[model samples]
Target: MENYHLTHEDGKYKLTKENGERASKVFESNKDEAIKSSKDFIQNQGGGSLKIHKNDGGFQEERTYPRANDPKKSKG
Candidate 1:
């Protein structure tokens, strides 16, 4: 499965593939908008893993799109 990330940088939020230097999308809105857009983008790409980071530079959470695509071994 593909893995993507949503991170805060340069006063903007970005969605990028894992370890990518370039953003696939840039969120000019609030974090809420960034999260929603990232979810849609991942879902449209056939679902995948998304790692979200807090503005404090710490890991926030991880989401698996489509719900059913979540790994069986992980409960959270």
Candidate 2:
């Protein structure tokens, strides 16, 4: 599994996956507002989640990791 990063820029936002494929588009107004709107768009697609954090430098969202199977445990 891999993580992706979404960033806010001038009049638009950017999405970059771990594989390095990037997609960007222009929004109407503020960058932060655009980012939140984009997040909503993604969540509406299906069972998805997103979180925004304000770091010392700027805001960021950390993607969640799926649970892995454990072979050491026997079936009950």
Candidate 3:
């Protein structure tokens, strides 16, 4: 599991994974549909999640996962 942040921009959304990996995708014309699709994509990328925080000039938010519990965390 990992934490990923999704930011909305230009009628699309950008995703950043826990390891700093990033990707972007276009969503449906409907705002709600776009948000749902973004969330689903994040969830499918393992035990991660997404959340909306602010609707500034662009949609901004932070996604967090338990450091000790996330499966993606490095074991040392």
Q: Pick the candidate with the highest TM-score.
A: 1
Per-residue lDDT, model 2, residue 74, is: 36
Estimate every model's Cα lDDT from 0 to 1.
0.94, 0.45, 0.53
- Arranged by lDDT with the best first, the candidates are 1, 3, 2
lDDT of each residue in 1-76, candidate 3, tens digit only: 5555555566665555545745545553555675667667765555465545343544355343332344455353
lDDT of 3 at 70: 44
TM-score of 3: 0.48
TM-score of each: 0.94, 0.40, 0.48
Better of 1 and 2 by lDDT: 1
| lDDT (tens digit, per residue) of candidate 2 on 39-75 | 5555444323333434232656543322122223634
Candidate achieving higher lDDT, 2 or 3? 3
Q: How many backbone clashes does candidate 2 have?
A: 0
Model 1 spans with C-alpha error above 4 angstroms: none
Report the number of clashing residue pairs per model: 0, 0, 0
Whole-structure CA lDDT of model 3: 0.53
